[model samples]
Target: GLIGKQPSAEMERKYSNETQVTPQTPPAFIFTCQDDRAVHPDNSIRYYQALMRNGVPSQLHIYPKGGHGYGKRFTFPYTEQLQYLLTDFLNEQLSK
Candidate 1:
């Protein structure tokens, strides 16, 4: 619910618009859902794309299911796997 429960259209637009622009230093990894309809998955995808295009060293994990919300309740079967993936990603980044 922490993802898109907020009912402020202005805030939503602001958040979406904010990520469209790439920052000087992007994080090494970004995990998001591809079918996130409420918050617009393109935001993460675009950011990831921008990072890749600029060679910022990052990765994106897009689940085929699950919309907004559903942070870590394991609503989907692969949620635990995602956690492992995140851990591995962080470890890899730290090792670098």
Candidate 2:
């Protein structure tokens, strides 16, 4: 599986995008599922935290359910709510 395939030294460069974030980074919107097994929800948390720490405007939504790969389509109880919230965030951010 992809998780078992740890990057060799040469491929270590292909990794998380966290380090690329900076104070000048643009605003961000992040979300994740608490019950997602394929991906740890904290990835979103960490990035959101980083964005806040770096002074970038951001919004994060961690649903109590909804697993990985929720994407743009409808899924789970809170999917539509999250989408609406995301839309609101986008509108607010883009307006400023």
Please give, for residues 1-96, the per-residue lDDT of candidate 2 as tens digits: 233566664443345545567899988878888998887877778778878888999888888877888785475788778779989998998789
Total colliding residue pairs, candidate 2: 0
lDDT of 2 at 84: 91
Which stretches in model 2 have alpha-carbon errors above 4 Å? 1-14
Cα lDDT tens digits for candidate 1, 1-96: 334667587766565633444555645566666678666677777777777776677778778777777675667756788789888888887887
TM-score for each candidate, following the candidate numbering: 0.66, 0.79
lDDT against the true structure, per candidate, is 0.69, 0.77
Clashing pairs in 1: none
